[model samples]
Target chain A: MSQPGQGLSVGLFATCINDVMFPDTPKHVAELLTRLGCSLTSSPAQTCCGQMFTNTGYFREGEATVEAYVEAFADCDYVVAPSASCIGSVRHQHQMLAAHRPALARKVDRLIKRSLDLTEFLTDILEVEDVGASFPHTVTYHTGCHSLRVARIGDRPQRLLRAVRGLRLVDLADSDICCGFGGTFCLKNPDVSIAMATNKAKAVADTKAEYLAAVDNACLMNIGGILHRIKAPVTPIHVASILVQQEP
Target chain B: MSQLTTLPRDTDGRLTPAPPPGELIDMPRFPINARHELANTDQRNNLQAATATIRAKRALRVSEVPQWEDLRQAAKTIKDQVDRHLDSYLLQAEQSLTKAGAIVHWARDATEANQIVVDLVKATGAPEVVKVKSMVTQETELNEALEQAGIAAWETDLAELIVQLGHDRPSHVLVPAIHKNRSQIKDIFLTEMGQYGTPAPADLTDDPSALTSAARTHLRNKFMRSTVGISGGNFLVADTGTLVVVESEGNGRMCLTLPQTLISVVGIEKIVPRFEDLEVFMRLLPRSSTGERMNPYTSMWTGVTPGDGPQNVHVVLVDNGRTSVLADPIGRQTLRCIRCSACMNTCPVYTLVGGHAYGSVYPGPIGICLSPLMRGLDSPIDQSLPYACTLCGACPDVCPVKIDFPEVIIHLRHEVAEHKIRDTKPHLETTAIAAAGWFFAKGRRFTVMTWLSGLVGRVFKAKKQFGAHMPWPARLWTSARDLPIPAAESFREWWRRNHERP
Candidate 1:
């Protein structure tokens, strides 16, 4: 397999949640991409892809966020995000935002095509699954609802995890069910949200893995919140954090 | 007649509680109702088990069909075509039904539909009527209407029977009593059966067949004695004037056949282009709904059949807010629903709280999409229905009719937000959301916002609120789970420090 000889121009979209809250997750992605021989750049003009506003019914606000995002990432070769849900919103809702505005619609079309989830970027765009990483722990993967259904990026993260030198990949039971971190849904319907997260949390514990790996940070925040609240031993880790590891 | 069975009359004038006034528009919000139902641990556990069983079975049954996607597309196309020319198809159905000795009545809404059925039953002079499990009739609250007219409507389907006897609203479409376990059902039967009809033996066990037998004994006389029967049509084949009802129990078949007079309350959207349309739906419905290869009993009746079945046949075609839904291109697709309950079975939200939380005749994804469209989002519950989802895409994947649930949900949310048509006026959250939009429109604004959040995180950390619980608004999220600590140095700051050249 011939790697891109010089380097690829890759833009990092540290999704809003990850940028402000869990900086380590996107930092791991930046480190991994840098190791894989990519010229990484972050646009200071970018905050989020407007997923929060989009999903929560604030379309006017969401559209503005999306327009700012396009302005930031329009020139990049491929824009990669560590979160599937943010990327999903960019891909789906951005189009919806531009449905009435033809000028923004064209730019959105171009930006959305190159926008990819970190896993999709690794496995499909770069054609690299094993990122030559190492993690000696039993990790169960939870496919977030957007990653599994909306983005439809299958087994890409798992394949990368499997290649990690000392990692033991265990399958989580009913891994496709949402972890109830449905952004607004968590706060809006906490009772139902808690029940759903409890169900996912049980499935996470059943694997008895040391860590739960998922593509989206929001889902981790939810399921991980439950595990933490219960004083469960499992630590929730992003797929990027696992893939960015080395023996030392 | 096979034999003269002793009809168990309500010797006392006392009747069970009437069904609610109507089922289209309901009262409580999703979160409020969800909170109440979530407290019912027993119901939650029961719903989980029942829905899990159906989900597994449905997946297996669907996998058996090699061209299941093709069947789904075919069904969508057929239904879409009907929606395109609904007026013509409905007229053709009415004409065909009339020609075939069936009196067809058009009802503008629930009141009119209920009145029509009450009058039809009154003309028959039957004190009691047997009923098939029908969602449309459930939506109209036909039983309550009949009760008001001094007619006792005995639900013959086992699940509907349980719901009726328990004096509870249905939580599921196919399995209305799914929230109750066999033991709970046994208790309901034992305590309430005597008040309605045949009393259960003092020693009725929780065994499935045993409970079933008790229900059977209770309903046998109703089927034998009732001269009037009412049903909700699953699909009204317009070209043939045929009404198709596919069911698991023989009760629906009995109700369709045994009575001297049969009145079926069908929604206008139930019309199909042709009789052959059943070929697609028949293959899809049972497999999608009950996960059966074929439903145990399928009853098809065109019209009056001399001395064989009901000599007096009446079909009430209802148009209560359906045309308005049809007018909406996005919402028009909702009328394509066959009520398979696949979306509900697959919905994670529905899995936790069951159908009662939705508070409508339709529940789960269907309820979310259809209820608001049929019954405007004027009420809190109807408005809340659209927001009661995770946008997980599970419903659309499982929906036999391919109703884009997330699309409809998002569209509905847009309606609520843009129009300011919410029950709770002047939302406090609206100010925050609008502020967020302004803050998020530019990257510099977001940087400042994150910086502010980090400052708050430091303040909260000093107060020990970060890992434990957050401030007032965040407290909603932090109550059940730990609050995520905002980063001291965000990724952008890190980039500016290292990667971004000064």
Candidate 2:
């Protein structure tokens, strides 16, 4: 049987955070999807999803960015992103931005249906659990709030990690709680954000896993900062980077 | 120069002074209050243990019922119906209550509600009252209002008793003293209980049974002696003109029955059109709240009994900012809340900083929506309240009535932004967001910004030295945690060299 991704063109929505801060995550996402037999496409025209603006309550500005996103991937077969949060905003908030106009709402609805978070596309549309990759390390997954609750992506990332040739997936304590990146919330309420991140980092350290893998790089960045700050033995790694590993 | 000279007491020997008048809101901005809360390590430890245990209990109980989701849907539907036809239902309720030989009063705001209750208690010629745990009363500052009129209101519920005795604000809806551990409660009781009413044993320990025994002894006298009882209803059954008060303790039953004159101050939004609608809430509230199959005491009375219970029954339908919440299309669903702290127990933010951080009686996710909607976004705290959550989407998932917390929170945020924009001067946060939105509107501008960051990255790498803190805003991030240096190679730069747009 042919792979589910064999004849599809996938638009890689390298979210702004990944584009500027952690390029490896989206680059790896592109790499993984291409190797899985999907044709990767992109528009350098794409930037932020305006989640920061939308989440911060600046709806008019967020709508401006939302229009740009629509124009960027308007022709793609499917819009997939390494960041679950931006995908969540696209699916959840884009309609509200377009709600004043019925024609635009219908167009945005079409885009929402075609969009998928990385783990979702892998298990849902592509139907492949094991991607024949190997990563010989004990890793735990931090379920990003957007990944777990917003997108409701469930255990697809964990399933993908479990299927890896040499990966041992450990359980994270209170893994469902937010890592506290929260877009602008990290800065707006740094005290609470750092407190939560510290707790999450401590939990990650207690697992004794070599790596903490999460779907969102923003979460990894926040937790990674705390992990690095506290000098914890564990490293924060994205699921894309781990899955893209060809050698243990 | 005696401490006793400073303290005032009512004729019945209950504490006469009322607590702060503000309800359902904290005073300062969220960051400031959250920092204060986060510093108290003991409170943090207590919160973590308490919320975790409650979350586990709720999850286990919720798992037992396969129809839990169905129950949530039914509850949501029933609440939605009440919100849509609230005026008609309120009228129907008044008719039913009057037919059942109960007096009905309407309160347009918290002050009006407080005045009605005070006047009603004064009419009974009562010096004090035993109160069933009521959040609406807290919202109206009713106890304080009563105290202002020289009438003492004695809290009958265990947690409420703890709060009242200690002169502490309620931190959680279900468990008012949720921020306090057993040891803390022991200290509060040892120090404050004797001053208020009955005294604790000299050798009172932090053991649960010991504490309960002490509280029972302290409150039993007040419960029996008080001629008036005050309560806030959980559900106001419109068709039968019934009011419900659910609690784990039997104090609600005692207070609802022992007093001759009973007064219930209910939010207009608490109405459920039919008596049978309670079957849905009875199932959802207990499991979601105390994590029990059913509460130990569920005191529900339709108007009154001829001679049994309190023959003089009064219901004050208070609309303190509730109409404001009802008017919003996006946020009206928040009124569906059943005051079950399921959202609180499961909320990660609430778990960390506890309810005190929210600075409101109704904390966690529900307050984030309801407080802003009811109070408006004009206040600094209310503006900051919407951003308090990490938007983790946990609260909505666990809400018994399926209130979409994140959606409402985001909507409130938009209102806050709009409110800020209406000010004469521009705001830094909104300006920054607008500028970022401008850059993101075009990939070229985004690329240029990334290139600037990459240039800074090169300079830092070349210098082999940079300050630990980047600058003003980034320093906020670096204060507690290390942040990544911007990548020298922008993704666009790498992608351009490697392949075409494809």
The iRMS of the candidates, in order, is 1.0, 1.2
Task: Give candidate 1 misplaced runs (Cα > 4 Å).
Answer: A1-5, B1-13, B17-26, B421-425, B460-465
Query: Any idea what lDDT model 1 has?
Result: 0.86
How well is each residue in A36-112 modelled by candidate 2, as lDDT tens digits?
88998878888877888888888888887777788888888899998788898899899998788787778788888
Per TM-score, the best of the predicted structures is 1
TM-score of 2: 0.96
The interface RMSD for candidate 2 is 1.2
Model 2: per-residue Cα lDDT over B1-502, one tens digit each: 1112123463455465345445445488888989999898888888888888888888899999999989999999999999999999999999999999899999999899998998988888787888999998888888878877877788888988888776678888888888888998999899878777778999999999999999999888788777789988999899999889888788889999988889999999999999999999999998898888888888889888987999899999999999999999999999898899898888878878887777666888998888888888777888899999989898888899999988898888898888888888989977777677778878889889999978977766654323356788878898877877777887877787688744
**Which residue pairs collide, candidate 1?**
none
Q: How would you encode candidate 1's per-residue C-alpha lDDT over B1-502 as one tens digit per residue?
A: 3432333444445355445444535567999989999899999899888898999999999999999999999999999999999989999999999999999999999899999999998887788889999998888888888877777888999999999887788998889999998998999899889877788989999999999999999899889888988999899999989999989989999999889999999999998888888999999999999999999999999998777999999999998889989988788999999999999999999988888888787889999888888888788888788889988888899989888989888888877776562535777668788888788889999889888977866666554224544577667777778766788778888888998778
lDDT of 2 at B22: 54
lDDT of 1 by residue, A66-121 (tens): 78888889999999999988898899889988889999999999999999999899
Clashing pairs in 2: B26-B359
